[model samples]
Target chain A: MAAAAERRPVWMRAMIYGFVATWFILAAFPFIWTVWGSFKVELDFFSIADWTYALTGERTKAEYGSAFTDAGYRGAWIQEEFYRNFFNTAIVCFFVVCTSLTIGTLGGYALSRSSYNYTFWLLITALIFRAMPPVTLVAGYLLPFFQWNLWGHLATTIIVLVAINQPFTLWMLHSFFKKIPQELDESAKVDGCTQFQAFRHVIIPVMWPGVITTGLFSFLLAYNDFVVTSMLLEEKNRTMVPQIAAFLGTTYTEGNVMFAVAAVVSATVPLFILVMFFQRQIVSGLTAGAVKG
Target chain B: MKHRTFFWFFLPTAIAMLLFIAAPIVSVLIQSVFAPHEAVLIEVENCTPLVGCTTETMIDQEATRDLREAQPLGRFVGLDIYLDRAHLAIEEVGQIWSTSETWGSFWSRIFNLPFYRAMSFTLTYTFVVTPALIVLGLMIALAVNSLHRHLKGLMIFFSLLPMIVTPIIGSLILFWMVDSRGVLGSALVSLAGDPNFSLKASTGLTWVMLIIYGIWSSAPFAFVVFYAGLQTLPRDTLEAAQIDGATRWQQVRYVIIPHLTPLVTFVALIQLMDNFRVLEPIIGFNASAHATSLSWIILNDLGGETRQLSSASANSVLTLIGVAILLSPVLVRTWQDFKRKT
Candidate 1:
């Protein structure tokens, strides 16, 4: 703990500081630039006259009589009806998270407690499923979903996401459940509680930390999903990501690129807020598998 | 847990996976072997004023619809789609193999084929990005670990921004900046001393931009994992190395790296699988013209006015096989571990 033990040479310290500073700029500058540019008109943001026009918002000021204007946001949210997509995304993420977590907890709890060989196989199967890029499954879903009249619905997309999310959820929650000493549940069972009762009484109360962490990831998977949501959901039911993608298709032709820019910034804010609030959990959740393995 | 109790607990998730994950693989496999039913063509003679009894084929719409409605899985081509020019292109590949005079020519011809083009980009991106991210992540983790305690949190918060944002959105944010009219593109234009210099117009630069974006977006995951590993480093060994007059480089090279070897494997396995799919960035950066991944190919097939289900399904199967190949080592390791446990 002494200062001498932690000491580094001046040059090495400077190099470390310099490298971190460079990485910080690389990591943060793009989003900062985009967010700042979103409020400007397309010309000022994507200024060919001078790059500094983006910062000054010269054209935006000339047009709107202010340095900053809500034109992009207004166009995206009001004119293009981005709020519909926002609400659709909210509905999908809400149900997907809830359903996936409920089933994932039950399954993960079972996997952690079971000593059977099948449990090993089950976990391995989940691993294999986890490795499959979700887009690969979109082709498969299209035929069946269309036939069964399940395509073009939020419910279908949500269920699909929940299923797609199960493997990772089960893995994270299984590891977490394993960490909760078996004796806690075993002792509850000995007190005349059935397995279900024991789980309800002992495990559920203590499982929130892991559940919340898993829930954050589930929300991310559903929220950040493009392939499944885009392919499955109808245009009217598209989520935020796909809606932004659609914006690109039309916006470029119409010279409304700022709508897509504004939409991209808007889509990113929730994630920024998420990381701010759950940095510890997100970090731990990322490392949990790595460290344990 | 008893079998009965476990069954009850696991049933819902099992059904979900079976219906969504497991069933889709089967469906994709089946669909890959089948092309959409060909239009039922019929020969008809039309005696017009200008032309008399010129035979021509026309699509019999009613019969075609009936045929499709009857089967619904499309005509069973049985690997024909997999070998056709759009997919595996078995015949085209053979033609190139036989006619080409040199390996370079052979590869160039092969690269012109859509499937090979996508596969090359996917594989190159996977292998290149995975290792690059690991190195970059390790560097950042080590540098941040040395920072004063208060500064560490702020650094980490900023560092997570690239990774935490949605992949498409993150790429779009970067994409806009790299547009010809935007900041970075103009900078490159000036630096290159050419007005026409554009990242999007070149295959090599597009790949470079995407690979850079891949590393930027994913390095934080590696850093977070590595930083966490660093926290658990045994202090005594480090102090002992110091007492033995080990240099800072030696301490890191020997003591730190060896300890992080397992986590390196962990990150490598995860990153390999993740990078192999590299789809969203291609879409966001509009790099599809210059580069495409397996996932991108499938997306292209599935999107637009024409939904080439069979072609997409074939690509999906091929992509899964690639994943299976990439994943074999880990699967083998897990199997060995299970065997030892039992």
Candidate 2:
């Protein structure tokens, strides 16, 4: 975005291109190869006979009698019941996003609109909580969750995740609320609407960008989390990331390593789709945190 | 907003934070000082012919059960647990220092304790990975910034995938590729001209792989921040530098870097906090045998069958302390900024 009008020498320009092109390969190669190799059989994917067998799918054809097979996916999804984990993840993420945004929007709107000293302390508290590792807090959660018999359920996990996510959510949404001109809501009040009605009528429609941005992160936290979900949830109530980890534990020794590989690739698909669709918002969200601070 | 409105609006999140976040800190703090109750013992005289007059002690199940039911949060042990080997490891560390002949041997012995071992790795990972990723991120940002516009979006789309993908899943992808017979691992073996080379077998190589994974997953974050910061760079300054005969390198060193320093600080702060608790990669790579972080140690304690809550809580307390120490500078800066604003 800076001025590029000043002409650079050909060698310098080529060096830049070379560096970036090399990185592009390094960054993209693992994912591309993994996705391709997931279709192949185990021996071909992790071929000791010849490394080229991985690329050529030769061993896959010999072993599975086809170039591609769904054995790994089937093993992970059907035999392993990974679909339940997937559904658990969806339920957790859906509620986490909804709960976090509902509270976050109200709190964020108030923080931005108010002129109290407490607001500063509230934000600071969030910052501190955000810095604490989620695992450390999991220790605190276990005794209580176990005592209450809430340890293994998705609802318990959802509540904990939403709490863990609130700091970031509130911080992001607070900054977001700060950017929206206060005059919009002020005029709504002047038009004889109560504060709640003004917020509902004026702020709700305009708050989606910030809400969606925050919601994506909440979803990511709830979905991607292994420590809290793994520790808190029961074996019967596993989520995708933890289930993928569980795959490595069981599937590896069973010589079903390809099943774990397939699970990893399956888990990545949603994130890939997310990044593809929401790259710009995610980029802006990252910078927004920086710039605002 | 009025006080009434502020209170009502803030209540839900505040309550959530209090119950889940704030209350847990207090729970961890209290639990850290308490060790679980030991079972009651009863001395009984054996009057059987084979046993003669020998006495044996047995666990008093009724008394122990009642005792446990009474104080299930565990007996308050003060700082006894924290000073034990699982935490500060005061006596062991002292013995190691006193017995070891040299600093090299001293460190080796000290790290044998799980607490010190985890702390050593966590600090090393944080110190090493934070700066390396910052530099890598900046380079990537500069390179991508100079690319043709059409390629920029596509490059960014690919780059964001690694960052957005779950940490365990992302590392699993890399871990599989670096499996002994997998692509990158095979490449390394062939490059080294050693068929036996494998990431799984070596601690040093595993740490390298973990650091590389850290950079791979996190650079996109720094890149995005720096890229956005680049867009906000003053064009006039660059033009003035050009007029002043600054070379391309000079233009970057003086103009570009100086401008992006704040964003660098921002990225560095966040990365420090992140790299400190590097847990998932250890799990995903199955590399805990090679390296364990503070978060991993805490997980180990909590995940075990005994559920060492006291030990885990102590580690959690220490971890939170470490987080606070790392966070202080940023907090102070934030405080200063807040004061100025108010």
Candidate 3:
């Protein structure tokens, strides 16, 4: 009787399994299908006569004399110079993460340690800034950028992204810093250290875990950004995301949809690897604010 | 920390935020109320040999260039841009209000205007997606929690894909599959028993598709949060319910849900703000004909050969107001919390 009560009924077990299976497919199937389809000719990938052609790649076999081909990858990476955009993305993400974290740590540390009321107001101000849509801010930037001859440059976009990233970065690091005991730094101050020295010697070394987590988010923001990059960067300096968007405009007309597909797959690879390694950090970062609040 | 010390530490970030975030907002405000100077017009009398002199109004190119170069911020027009047809469309709304007999007709007529159309979709998407994602996330969290330990990690890894991938890429992947020639699109066509069926062709179905995409991409965030919340559940309370002969449903209803209520609100608040800025998915899906968002409208206005800076700025100001309204409750609650702490 105890065993019977402990175990779920057969129907209940089956229901749970069925639901999980559906969600698993819902989450995973699209990417798997697209990656598989990306190797084939457009005809086979988007086959109207038979869907199985996508899986079997019948036209691809006939055209390329093999089941798989890298024609799309060749066109995107070579002919279209996607590597330039990839390089631009790398540069932007690197600088944005470094600059945002440096300033964010200082500000966030101050916000956490200060016992003043203005710190509270500053945080509230950051929260309001965080909620404003990036596009709305872009409207304000155009006139000034054009006037100052700063439009369509990587440096301008990177600085703007860092500033936009500041609010969230500051908030996340502020919360993380709050968890660190104030006594660690206070004792350093007692031991004949200035405030900056205490922060540099005592707090900085222990802040890596929180900083790394915050850095991952900053990297993602810069990497996955579309609006800012698309609006601010020139055609030659476009990042992976805006480049992919640009691909769609031309690819659709030229019957080169597979190039866009391949480019998207290429763009997703680094993120895929990032999640694989930093899954724990990502999960924890997401819950940090929610759990505490 | 001393005030001077704190000031030095906070200066870099404060400068960044002030110049980029705060200044742009001020710029948007100023831009919204101003219009670019009209090309300086001059009237000239032209006479051809066989025709009488005719006074012709022509754009004075030299003067226009000088004017624009001198005052690059444009001429101040007060609130005219905000009231234009592309934005708030006050005159259009008034006409629709007076002419339409029923509430439904009035609403339909008003929605035909671009700004109202974008607002309706943005609001509907926000309100619908936030709650729906929370519910779906809870269900997934509960179900995944019941699975074997080994399978749990694998499920989470796969689940994070939709959320972690670039928004445009994820939407494009889904959009391709739902194209009329693609697999799901074909299956949908067959299911509906119509050869011409396409998800992108209808406004209602396009919205439903986008809403589904919204839930799919965001449900993982909620799930991860709720699942973490579930791990911290008090085991003794569950055992107490079990000893009381509480069925599984009753345990979930009475014990589990009450514990997870705070988490639900957290997820709802975060998702609301994120969904209100839905633009990339619309672009990825290429469904702007059927659906438009406030962010998308702003982007469209700012793009093209002639950048309509004034119009876009007005839309930006309006969007900011909407965000402020949506955010007031959070702010008020935060203030109360601060008061309590003090």
**Which numbered prediction scores highest in DockQ against the true structure?**
1
lDDT of each: 0.93, 0.89, 0.94
Can you give the DockQ of every candidate in the order shown?
0.81, 0.77, 0.68
Tens digit per residue, CA lDDT, model 2, A96-198: 9999999989998999999889888888899889899999988889888878888898998889998999999998999999999999999999999999999
Itemize residue pairs with steric clashes in candidate 1: none
Query: TM-score for each prediction?
Result: 0.98, 0.98, 0.98
The list of candidate 2 runs beyond 4 A from truth reads A1-6, B49-51, B340-342
Check candidate 3 and list the clashing pairs: none
As a whole number from 0 to 100, the lDDT of residue A79 in candidate 2 is 84
User: Model 2, range B191-233, lDDT digits (tens) per residue?
Assistant: 9899998988988998899989998999888988998898888
Q: Give the candidates in order of DockQ, highest first.
A: 1, 2, 3
Better of 1 and 2 by lDDT: 1
True contacts kept of 2: 0.80
Ranking by lDDT: 3, 1, 2
lDDT of 3 at A56: 92
Q: Candidate 3: which stretches are off by over 4 Å?
A: A1-6
Writing each residue's lDDT as its tens digit, candidate 1 over B201-245 gives: 999999999999999999999999999999999999999998999
